[model samples]
Target: MEVYYSKSAKDALREMTCKLIEVMRAESDNIPFNLALSGGNTARQLFALWQEEYRLLIDWNRIRFYWVDERCVSPEHEDSNFKQAYENLFGPLGIPQTRIYRIRGEEDPSKEANRYSELIDQQLPKKNDLPHFDAIILGIGTDGHTASIFSSCHFLLNDIQIYAVSKHPDTGQLRITLTGPVILNDTPLLIPVIGEDKRKILERLLEARTATEDFPAACIVYRAASAFVFTDITI
Candidate 1:
């Protein structure tokens, strides 16, 4: 694991984008670069930044976008992760639909999870019998959840499936998320944890050297193939 510190959220995100571009560029252009993305207010900020300044820096054509998780709602729903990316990043970049593999959130949660899991298994490259994404970008919730693996749903940390259905600990809202096994595959995990609100949680996560039940984010930090954290919080 490695950490990059920034003075502000925008600066952290700027550095994150540059790092992503660097990773994408290192890949062979003949093949598609698979990237998994998370959705949240922080992601919205990153998308906006991409639309404004980094659009030209990335080879949008070679990029295949996938979601790390999605709310169990219609794609057009206000809470839909795909909707957030489409409106902010895809629309502005004119990324083709052929390259976008979104989880059908409106469908039955179990069925959607199975469908998406299969889709990824068939589309992405495989290493050690698991689909290998070039990179997986995720955001951390203040509660220490990452990719919908909340404290209440810690079982997902060992779920054997590539994707699984998860319920929000408080609201019981259904979500489809990449399971721990797949998430910890031979792929880079990129995280941008910004804002003063995250400092304490980040500190706690940093202090813990191994996966703990209380802080799900610590699992990724300790077990991922490689993890890079970009943050603005001064800690």
Candidate 2:
């Protein structure tokens, strides 16, 4: 796990974007870059920047898009992560239809998770019976949740596949989230976080020597090939 402190949310987003551009430019492997994107305000900023100007720095066709997690909502819904990314980034850049693999959030939760698992099998490069993503971008909540895995309950953390269905304990909303073990075994992981509210959990996550079920975000850093964190919060 590595931590980078940005002076503000804007600076954090800038740093995160710069890191992504660096990755794309430096990549020499022939396989398409598999990116699992998270949703949040900072992500929205990143998406907008890429769509408006920065995305031209890399080969768009060689980059494929996936979601780290998605709320159970229509693609057109205001709360939909895919909608935010599409409106801000994917659509504007005319990303090819075949390259975008989104979770069917509007469908039944368990079935959609299974479908996404199949999609991962079909789209991503396989290693040791699991699909490995090139990058998985994430965001953490104040309550210490990453993706839909919350601190309030014991989630099914032992799944062997790429994605799983977890319900938000409070809202009861279904979420399709990439599993912990799969994330730990994948490529570089980026967590760009912001706001004063995030400071405490960020510190704890940074200090974690072992991943715990209580703090799901720590699972991302557990045995991960490389982990980079960009944050605006003070620890």
CA error at residue 178 for candidate 1, angstroms: 0.2
Give one digit per residue, the lDDT tens place, for model 2 in 1-235: 7778888877887787778778876776676988999997878887876776676676788888999899999999988999998888888888877888888899998899999988888877777677888778978887778877777643656666567888888888888888876776657788887877777887788788887887777865665778888988877
Clashes by residue pair, model 2: none
Error of 1 at 120 (Å): 0.4
lDDT by residue (tens digit), candidate 1, 1-235: 8899998889999988888888888889899999999999999999998999987788888889999999999988999999999999999899889999999999999998999999999999999899999999989998899999998888898899999999998898999999888888878889999888888889988999897866779987788878999999887
Clashing pairs in 1: none
* Model 2: residues with Cα > 4 Å off, grouped in runs: none
Candidates in order, TM-scores: namely 0.98, 0.91
**Which of the numbered candidates is closest to the native, going by highest TM-score?**
1
User: Which portions of model 1 miss their true places by more than 4 Å?
Assistant: none
